[model samples]
Target: MRILRTDIQILRAIAVLSVLVFHFDLPGLQKGFLGVDIFFVISGYLMSRVIIDEMDAGRFSPAAFYFRRARRLLPAAMAMFAVVTAVVPFALTMGALHDYVQQLLGALAFGANLVLWAQSGYFDGQATLKPLLHTWSLALEEQYYFVLPLALALIGRRWRAAGLVGLLVASLLACQWWLRRDPSGAFYLLPTRAWELLLGSVCALPGLSARLPHREGRSSIGFDSGWLWLPIMAWCLLRGVDSVHPRTDALLVCLSTAGLILQPSAMLQSTRPWMRPLQWIGDVSYSLYLVHWPLIALAKNIWLQKVPDTVLWALLGLSFVLAQLSYQHVEQRYRNLPTPRALLRQMVWLLVPLLLAMGALALHMHMHNHSQAGGVAQGQQPVYGFDARCDQEGDFEPLPACMNTPRPHTMVWGDSYAMHLIPALQASPPDGGVIQATRSACGPSLDMARQSPQDPPDRGQRCIQFNRSVLAYLRQHPEIDVVVLSGRWQYYLDDPVVDARGRFIHPGQHEIAASFARVVQQLKAMHKRVVLVSPPVLLGPDVDLGLCGQRAAQGLLTVMRTLQTHCAFERSLWETRQAKVNAMLTDAGQLADIDMIALDAFNCDDRHCVTVMDGVPLYRDFGHFSQDGARLLGLRMKLGQKLRASAR
Candidate 1:
């Protein structure tokens, strides 16, 4: 109804800045994700106000409203999409480019959130490589736009206020429930995000706005009471806890923002000298938001070859310049053009860019696919395979040749990370030694576990069956001399312990020690040499080798070193868990009379765990070793000598 207010502009700046700092890996900005919630609320309030005003005057036009939205959202999005599509082929590996192309198509179709949700559920590292990872917000907003108008039309004038409020509350509750059950899905999908916008929708209703007092001076609330809400909001932003439960924190931020919007006081207003630039940035906020991320990613990549802080700042400055110019020349001109005719022109303009983007994305995918096919033909490395049993059971089966062949002199088996070690194993094969393996998504343990928190009862049955099949395979493979067991083990250490029925047991009480000990005992009875490989040190929960390389190039040596040190220190948790399991193994080993190889010292020194050893990353992610890292580790352990001698 009104052009953007100074306060609203100020809020926009806050939102964008929070996100920028978060993306830059600045401390205390981890909660910057809340900025998307702020944007959703603002979008709801503004769009609802316009729709209500137009509908009351009997001049509402869905076609015109949607056209305006498309013009506002699609052009810059397609621009970013086009740029990313063109650059990805040259910048990313073939496997990475294929994933990016899929993400691009999903973003273009406004279903990026769903694609991301499904991908996240699969436990793949592909999520980190997606350039359009931010499109989940746009998808949520588009989904809201699709439903909100028809909802307003149906309720009519008399009952609309109560109906809308009721719907908003119901949706909010539903989202809360769903988040607790399937947080990964809730985090990325549209339905779980609808309530945040609806809260803003309810606030925009005519009578609701009128009910609040329009005081000339600030309402008589004291300084303590007035300022308390700020820290309460800030605390929610700073605290980083496990998001296992439904997020009540988002609602807290949303409600606090609603309060600030409804009753702006002197304190809430931005009058400080510093606030001016942020406010200015807020003015062209939409363009700034669209352009910043891809630029940052590109800068990170280009400078990764040889980075300096000056270069980073220069790239940031370049991005700002490009954003401002785009805002002034492109966005401003189109947004202010006359209606209907402007709408038609905007549609044509938007469609051309989208089509071009789609074309570029397709080309990128084609090249990537061809590259991967060639790599496979040349026997570079195979990252994926199909298991016959997995196909029959409607699950990801074990690789067909993963474990069924005649037992080799040595065998390495576990997850994808372990699979990546195949190249290194092949490179340094012991004379007269043969190695075979089975690798899959689940950890090396054959214990029954759920794929997801929302997994049905059938999953338990499936896991039990799978474990039995694995046990039988192991029983039949007695000739496999050295069983090198490895996996992304750290992921399992903190998992909630459960009983056979999958009911949670008390913390620090449920034990898997005996079960693990028995598996070791079984292997020992078969006269298989057991080498329990420990997890590598991790820098963070998720790892991006490209990002790490960029940081290293930038001469952020302290940061990189600290990350490696922290990861090495954190590996003690795994060691502690291993101590308990190993004690059990020690007792079992005495009775079975077998040798247990401990390889924890392979990647660690007294005070640090080095991610880069001899100029190679020890890990692809936080805990799993990269191919190069694994090879280096294998070499350090004298794997070839030990395996060949054991076979003899």
Candidate 2:
């Protein structure tokens, strides 16, 4: 009744291997994420073929289709989830456990994609820490399955082609629009992704393959363009791991995959000896995909360093072996039950119970973390800024400084760095209360063209509008003086260097200086006193002290901290890394006649720059201060005295 294509199996192998290689950090497989796009196309084709064939035969059942999917996908997925849940208490810190619990809940409910979409940018530094992040693809596929059958049935035998074409066109358009506007939504949601799957469905249409001429050397079905597909794969690989993304950029890969499936030639179908291993991996690919990421995450969490090649190879071997075991035992064992009713019963008995248990565990961990956090005094919470605008970046809304300020006098402006200064400014308000006009990545730099890729999309535009509004507010009220400018100035200098005169210099230090100059000039034109605050000393991996402190302070799941040592690095390391940016800031201050405040000058010694001082951790993470750390910094810097003098 059903014909299995060896070529399709080969493609499956290719897809899985690419993904594995990418996740394993194998060099040159940067575009290995294209494997997922390949999978989407394959899924679309295979599911459509099966559904269409059944419908034509007058034997199709939507209930039976979904039952088959649940049986095939859920068993292995749930098993992997169970293992992750068990590993959490042992491997994850309480804070991490709380976060993972939320992800786990999302995974179980077929909403992991949505959860990840909302949590943070997919390419964020924290993405590697999430074991369930790979599940977003699975969630996306499952959501597709939910609606496909009904849509196909509604199209009927007569209009299936037209309907699928319309669907594909609409979805592709939506994906293009959304990718530019809201990349995360386009990436994770089914509506934007439906077209890729439907492309495969289009390939499976009854007479689609009849059009391609058969070639003798390239097997029975002779569409021999094997070399053509290479360029497509190469284009995808060129994108690399950091740049792996979807939408229009993914169209080429998806179309190529569809072309391969639709026109399988001898070039594609040859079952050579070297290809056997790939076919084998293909057989167990789903299982491998499920198990590999969590293993990598667990290893990273424990080691807290880059995994060595030797260990990575060993992990790869282990993942393959485990995948074989899972494929044979769990996936195959449960994939075929006696009947639909029996399968449903097993799903209810086994799958439902597992999901419920994980959900409950996640809920319990989340509540425990919240309760522990509740015990700390509210004032001790880290302050970035009091204004709602400070936390969120958006279009400007004019508001009086007195809205959040007890006495509106000084204003803090910059990026997230400015937010950290809020504590000190609040501790010692200016003649009027200190107000904050800040965005997370919105530096005070007037140059809108130099926005960071790490920043939110439209950040450049938002920064421009925000700066314009702030300048307008300053002009409107001469009462608000003493503008304290603070941000991670070093961040902007992370690009290719240019010279002081804006000439192309090697790793140039001048752009940051120029940016600072522009910002200071604008504020100075308004006759506002500009105070430049130096960035806090940045640290390495040891800076994730909050999680360590949480474990030590609150023994969640019996995690005990034996030592009082804080995360710190040598003063030399800090000076070496920050010297250029520091020089730029100091120069900017001198040229602009602005008062520059150096926190590092007081906090660091020649020996080592401690992350903690007198039992209070100076940093919550790598750069930002914790609430207690901020309070202590305010006192140590004598920010109140400085602000009072500056105001005078």
Model 2 lDDT per residue over 1-648, tens place: 234676777788888888888889888766788889899999988888888889999999887788788788988988888777866666665545656777888987898988888776511325676778899999988988888888988898899999999999999888777766677788888999889999998998998842333232452434476666756766775563244257434788888888777667455566688877877877898999999999888765554435667878999999998899889988888877858777667655556656666776667565655764432223223455565445655644445531355446678777778887777656654456677777766667655423443333455666667677777778887877778888776655664222223333333466567667787888878878878888887643333444443333334332113223444557777777678777888777776777777787656777676655665545555567666667778877778568557531
Task: List where candidate 1 sits over 4 angstroms from the true fold.
Answer: 1-3, 126-128, 210-228, 240-246, 270-274, 299-315, 340-385, 388-484, 491-515, 522-648
Candidate 1 global TM-score:
0.70
Each candidate: what lDDT?
0.58, 0.70
Any residue pairs clashing in model 1, and if so which?
390-397
By summed lDDT, which 10 consecutive residues of candidate 1 come out lowest?
Answer: 372-381
What are the per-residue Cα lDDT tens digits for candidate 1 across 325-344?
87876677667556767656
Best by TM-score: 2
Provide the TM-score for each candidate, comma-separated: 0.70, 0.87
